[model samples]
Target: MTTTKERALDAAICLAGSQGIRAMTHARVDAAAGLPKGSTSNHFRTRDALLAGVIARIAEGERADLAPAARGPIHSIDEFVDVFTAVVTTLTGPHADRTRARYALFLELSSDPELQAPLRAQRAAFAELARILLAGLGAKHPDAAVEAFMAFGDGLILHRLTVDPGAPVRRSVAIAVRGCLEA
Candidate 1:
């Protein structure tokens, strides 16, 4: 069973994803979660707290989804593509709403430098993971490859999220990974 905190956080994510960050107030989260008024506020006392919770939740969900690929070092282009495909499909499919919400929150929180720490940490973690994978893939400069791959993935995700939901993201991911690996 989901805890009240988790429910409220989930509701916040869904609300942000579907209706944008402006719709993610505590009262709205409580109503969306079917919890009593002030329930969300009880868990997260401030808007920053709520935004942080949403960011942390998104990271947790992504870590779980990507766990399978983290079991071992990626050994080949095909293996990497398979993992990339799974990730892209999830991001562009079932998790699209939350992903969109994240982007919305990212933009909304940009003016609040203090609220951006978790997002920066998340990006750093992804970059570290990409560095490891790129090294294993024999990229000439793993650090540069990490930056390029992340930029490609982020751009691809953002484009697919906003403009063309039906874009062949998996194929695009494969191409991008192939280019990174071959460069």
Candidate 2:
């Protein structure tokens, strides 16, 4: 059984995946969740508040799904890569369309302080966690390594959406990962 909030968040995620986040509204959310129109008010009270809740929920889901911070000391770094690989595969594969939609929202969010805060917090927290994981791996410049890894991942994602009409994504990620780890 799912609570209204849980179900609403799920609907929001799928909607954000299918349609751009900007296109999702409380009315649409109620419709998507198969609830009466008052349902959004019952849970979140306002549209902006509801959108924030949905974004927070998505962050929570990513944290759980990634699970990179759940491993032991040294192997945690390896596990991080494994978790990252799985996540990238999912986000870029069957979910690709929705992901592009989400990214579009994220780009818009970059210039909106209200939305930027949480997004920045999410990224900063993830970067910090990644830095900690890399530290245990004996990288002399763990912070730099984490930054490089993140930059590489983002670059590959953008590149995937652009040129190299002949290259594969995982192949691109592989090259970045190997280059970062070996460098």
Candidate 3:
């Protein structure tokens, strides 16, 4: 019941999730989407085009996740915690195995430089969003605050990926945030 374009992006997301960006060929995507094997090419002439679509979809989701903070003054550190918690929830899932697999997907992304540009840009956008949030935190150097927060948050995820967390991502973020900021 979906359009060819829809099928193509769906396939791209699932393929990239399961096999990483490099393995997301037209043939693989078509098979994943349950559409004709040539539909990826029919909708997106090249791999770049298909990958672009995938980035667009994922970035859109990321933006949606930060919708509230993006629009308002994110002064309360508590509010950032809420937003970061939701974002981490999406990455980690409600289950431990899903969280581990999501971390693996994060690893898969690191291996695909060609497909990482859009992802990098989206990350910049999130950084800018954090700058806006930092302005509310009474920090004179918004850029520095953004960098610090992102670095700490990312390190937390990477550490959790390699550790056996009894309380999981929500707890991990809480601990990281507490350590990253002062009372």
Judging by TM-score against the true structure, name the best candidate.
1
lDDT of each: 0.86, 0.67, 0.66
- Residues 1-92 of candidate 1: C-alpha lDDT, one tens digit per residue: 99999999999999999899999999999999999999999999999889999999998988877776787898987888788778877987
Angstrom error at residue 95, model 2? 5.8
lDDT of 2 by residue, 1-183 (tens): 988888777776677766777667777878998988878778888766776786787677666655645454536344555666666666566555445645665776777779657767777887877677666655567778889988976666555544442335555555555555556
lDDT value, residue 162 of candidate 3: 51
* Candidate 2 residue 180 C-alpha distance from true site, Å: 1.9
Residue pairs in candidate 2 whose N, alpha carbon or C atoms collide under 3 angstroms: 17-98
TM per prediction: 0.94, 0.78, 0.75
lDDT of 3 by residue, 1-183 (tens): 868888778667766655555767899888888888788898789876876676776666667766766777765667777778777665544332333433444566687876676677877887887767666666566666677878876776555445533335566555555544532
TM-score winner between candidates 1 and 2 = 1
